[model samples]
Target: MSTNLNQRLFNAADSLRSKMDASEYKNYLLGLVFYKYLSDQLLQTVVEQAGELLKEYNSLEKQEKLYRDFLEDESTKADLIQTLKDVINYDIEPDYLFHHLAKQAKQGTFQLNDLHKGFIYLTTNFEQFEGLFDDIDLTSRKLGQDDQQRNITITEVIKQLDEIDVLSHDGDVVGDAYEYLISEFASSAGKKAGEFYTPKMVSKMMARIVTLGEEDRKIFSVYDAAMGSGSLMLNVKDYIKDTRNIKYHGQELNTTTYNLARMNLILHGVDNENMNLNNGDTLNKDWPTDEPYLFDSVLMNPPYSAKWSSDDSFMEDSRFMRYGRLAPKSKADFAFLLHGFYHLKDTGTMAIVLPHGILFRGGAEGAIRQKLLEDGSIYAVIGMPSNLFFGTSIPTTVVILKKNRTDRDVLFIDASNDFEKERNQNKLTEKHLDKIIEAYTDRDFKDKYSYLASFDEIKENDFNLNIPRYVDTFEEEEPVDMAQVGAEIKEIREEQKQLQKELYDTISELTYSKEDEDWIKGALEVFKYED
Candidate 1:
């Protein structure tokens, strides 16, 4: 049923392709979708808890007795809303509910002011709902120059979203559709899109390796420093089932994307209490500061080679203080990694996506790599295929880190050859992703694909951890058969000599064997072999 539901939602998104920019449409449509889910979920809770009262009220209304008579003295509306708040931590008034607005829209009587009031009310009542609708503006000049046109456009999207029964199932239905919308928006958003989007296939692989043995653990926590749209963080929860023990912590730098990450978490059904998300610069001000960086699993996909302050004062910051050298100010890849690593629990595992430069770049980055290796913090390096990302085609690598592992060797997986071309971008199919997970799980050597490099081997090359330096994927050329080549050359010369004689005889027949025979032979000499 949800398969069809997802299809319907995507088709609805396609309806707006010509209406606005894909990125802009995502904000408008998904905000409506989120609003719809919230309103729908509230009504669903009311139905389950107050069905008897609602039915009685409806029966009374049909018999010429209005709802006022049934609820005049009881304050039934307030009672019901407070009841919902006790359980769901939020409430949507009757007039502002999705079903109510949907009916009004069908009759062409819906008011944009009503929705605006509702959104304002949401923030005024609950802190978590704040800024969710900030990115979505109904009165924006992009929507329309006048209120009437804007109302028409807004009504159409609300009606379309209302068509989706977000509360139809108890699974991640709404969240899955929400993720679909995010991915579609990112595909058309260009380089800026890479900031918040990590392919689900790659997320799955990272989830698997990070949560390998902890899948069934009753209590577990995962963190992503650069949370982006929170997809990577929530994706970590897909593997663990005991939600009671699940703790999610993350921080995003971009305010718009940060709001998106927060909405994504709630839409996916993760409770507010379970989430510890923050909107701040992870490098300058670390979130989860109260928790002291002890997550059981840490996942990150920070922008490649992003810039950071890298001030000398950071030399004293615990995350970088131990490394002996901070990452270059021009490239803060190592800075992001070390921040996540610092917060990781001794028993935790982390997987991060970074460019190949981190493996061999000299100066600060190289020193940091050497310190991590000597301390046995580096676990495995998985080379991803080029073009796997949307905007940039540069191939990236996923480096797995562990705080407590005793293994002194790094697993080098040359999975750069394992993706399929999808239109313009490269993607890791399930088969390709699964193979990487298997190689990582087995941690055994595979010819031409994976190699287990020891600590001494890394030290021998001056700590250059480039994949090609370890895993030999080179193919040897086949030796040529010189004797067979010589024989073939002789055969060709004999055939050429016979052809020349036949030509001479044909000429003799045409001229009665007397038409400038020597001249003809001399002219044909130009065609003879140089040797």
Candidate 2:
């Protein structure tokens, strides 16, 4: 069933790619898909209530006449819209309905202007309401260079998506389709993928490690500093059952991705008010700057090695001020680390993926590491396999920080070799993730795999957080047997002697026979005497 749905969805997406670029194509197609999802859900609720009303009215003597009258009544239509608004948790006017648009599209009269107006009408009507089509950009470049192209592209995309039942019991089907498109675009977006989309396995590991051994009903708030499409933040919802109790918050720098994040949150059925998507740089200007805000669970896969202004002005910034030095203008890994650390609540746990350089870089980074370790907030550092990301092959580490750690020692798991190699990419399977989580939860110090480094020990190493320095993953060679070695040496000597004899025989035969050996010796002697 998933295969069939995927094929149909892919075909629909492929049909519109010619009119737009792959990256832009995603936004356009996904916006229409989300619109269809909202419309379908709203229509389903209305139809169900309509059916109930018709059943009740059918008990009268003029049952058929009453049903016809109710269907045609304007007040009944208004009530249906009201019920739809209330039940679906969003306002969907009749004109914005997917079936209505599909009908117009099939009749060849649904022009781009009409579709754009419908989308605008949808958002404007619901602007005062709770859940609205806040992310769909009618003027987005993804639609086309101009109105004509954009309309054609959107109309066809909507027509194709309108064929599927996106509001079925398997309602996540629409989200799954959207995720497939996200993964496709992420591959082509290169480093930009890190901004919004985290590898699924990495998100799983973060969510699993943070929620280890705890009941799904445990109330907690999950946040991400760079919540690209809000995938990482939303993945936590799947890991936990009582997600309604958990509030989702995130800040994205890219306007497009910020919009995507909000759309993704709503499409996944997250209450719009519960999920806060902010646009702007998280390090410099925090959008949702509610003082001392902290989360119970934080997971982030920020851009690897991004550059930022570590100028003197930012020295006074609270996120970096406490460190006493700025991260180098060339590398912002530590900057993100400090930000995540600051937002960590006293009872919160945060997991972040960073380049290995953060572990051993000298100067300002070193001082920050020293402070983090000294404060006992650094919980565990697990080394992940290489090529786990979309654009780069560099191995990354997941540093788990906790404000309320039971142990003073930090857990280090050398999971560098724990991955499945498929094609050209390395993936963390369920087993690999489970093992890392087990070691982290149990705080096990397995030989050659994990170690518990104390604060003093880390300080003794001058605060170098390198994994190899703490957990010696090197394996020693086995000792050789002396007696067997000596016997093998003797056998080699005898074999050399026989090989020399055979060589001498072959050379002597090629030059002169044994009978000419004496003659050659006598000639050598005579020549020496003459000299």
Candidate 3:
């Protein structure tokens, strides 16, 4: 049933592809779906509260009418809304409900202004929801050349979303469905997707690795400095037993994506207070510079090789000061890693995705790598396959860093080849992820797949943490049998001799001029056996 609903939701997005690029159209489609989710939650809560409110209405139309009737009563309207606010900490008026707007759209009475007001009400009334709907441009000419056409387009989308029973299923299912839509948009967004989303398989892998042995904790905090869509942080929740006790901290440079991360967390039913999301550049500035700044786990997939203002000012910042040298301005991979690591608790685990260059790059990066290794802060380096990301095809490595690790050896897993090919992208399946998790948790060395490289071995190699230097994935070629080759060559030669003699006999049977026949026979002489 969830699969069917997900398809219908994606189809709605598909309907708008002719209007704009997936990068742009996704804002409208996802916005409405999110809006519908909020409205449905309110309506569902109302039904659950009133008990008799929706029980008689077998059809959505009747239920919506019933809701409209209930709201029309002036005596009960305020009391009902207050009750909803008390329960969910928010309320949507019946006039602005998703079903009502969808009904308006279905009847050709929908106004783009009405939807605009709904967005306005939420943003104006709530601080958390402020600027949330700013990305969904109802005024865009791309929706259509004019107002009525745009209304028709948005109307069609709302009506399509109306079919989704967002309240009939579990909140987690709805949230997962929302995630499905985000992923679909990400796939369509191509290179642009890196700005907002990470492939779920990778997120799951990092989540499992970071949450290992720490699953039973009553209160766990996870932070992502470059949190794209907040999926990585949410994955940490998936692996924890007490998900509700988890607090999420994230900062994104893109406002649109930050809004997406907010909606994602909210839909996942993360309490508003539990989400600490900021829309700003994580490198140029720092966030959560207050109480509870540190986290138990820091999971990140920052933009690879992205340029940052690595000014001398940042050297004074606590995050980068310890390294003595800064990550190169041209590649902020180490810079992001250092920031996330700084926010990690002494007992916390941090897993980050960076370009393979960080493993061996020289100069500033080399200096920083040496410091981390010397301090035994670097935990494990796992090399993942190329094209597993959305935009770039360069192979990436997940560098796991832990604070206060007594072990001096770093585990290296060469998982670069263990992925299922999915058309244009490489996917890490459950089996592939399980193998990596087993290897990571066991910390056991498997030849050609993983290795436990000691500090001495790393220093011997000039502190280069490249996987090839430690975990050798090279396959030795099978030994050749010279006698078998010689026998095959002899058999081929014997067959060739018989075939040549038969060819000469067949050529002798054909009629030709003497001069021409002699020329052909001369060419055939080159094919005769040596004997």
TM-score leader? 3
| TM of each candidate vs. truth | 0.82, 0.79, 0.88
Question: Looking at model 2, which ten-residue stretch has the lowest summed lDDT?
Answer: 58-67
* Number of the predicted model whose lDDT against the real structure is largest: 3
Per-residue C-alpha lDDT of model 3 across residues 1-531, encoded as one tens digit per residue: 577678777878766888887777767767777888898777667666777645665555665565666689998778878887777778876678788888888888989898889999999997778999999998989888999898888888887888887666553543355456545666565655654566779989999998999989999999998887787788887889998889999999988888988888887878888988888989988888998999999999998888988899988999999899999889998999999999999989999988899999999999999999999999999999998877667898999998887877899999999999976678899999999999998898898999999999999999999899898777889999999999999999889889888877776677788779777787567655555
Candidate 3 lowest-lDDT run of ten:
170-179
Q: Rank the candidates by TM-score, best first.
A: 3, 1, 2
Candidate 3 or 2, higher TM-score: 3
Task: Give the runs in model 3 whose Cα sits over 4 Å from its true position.
Answer: 1-6, 52-59, 167-188, 482-531
Model 3's C-alpha root-mean-square deviation from the true structure amounts to: 3.7
lDDT of 2 at 119: 72
Better of 1 and 3 by TM-score: 3
Give one digit per residue, the lDDT tens place, for model 2 in 189-275. Answer: 344554566677888889887666444656768888888777777777766778777688898887767776776777677775676
Q: Residue 260's C-alpha lDDT in candidate 2?
A: 68
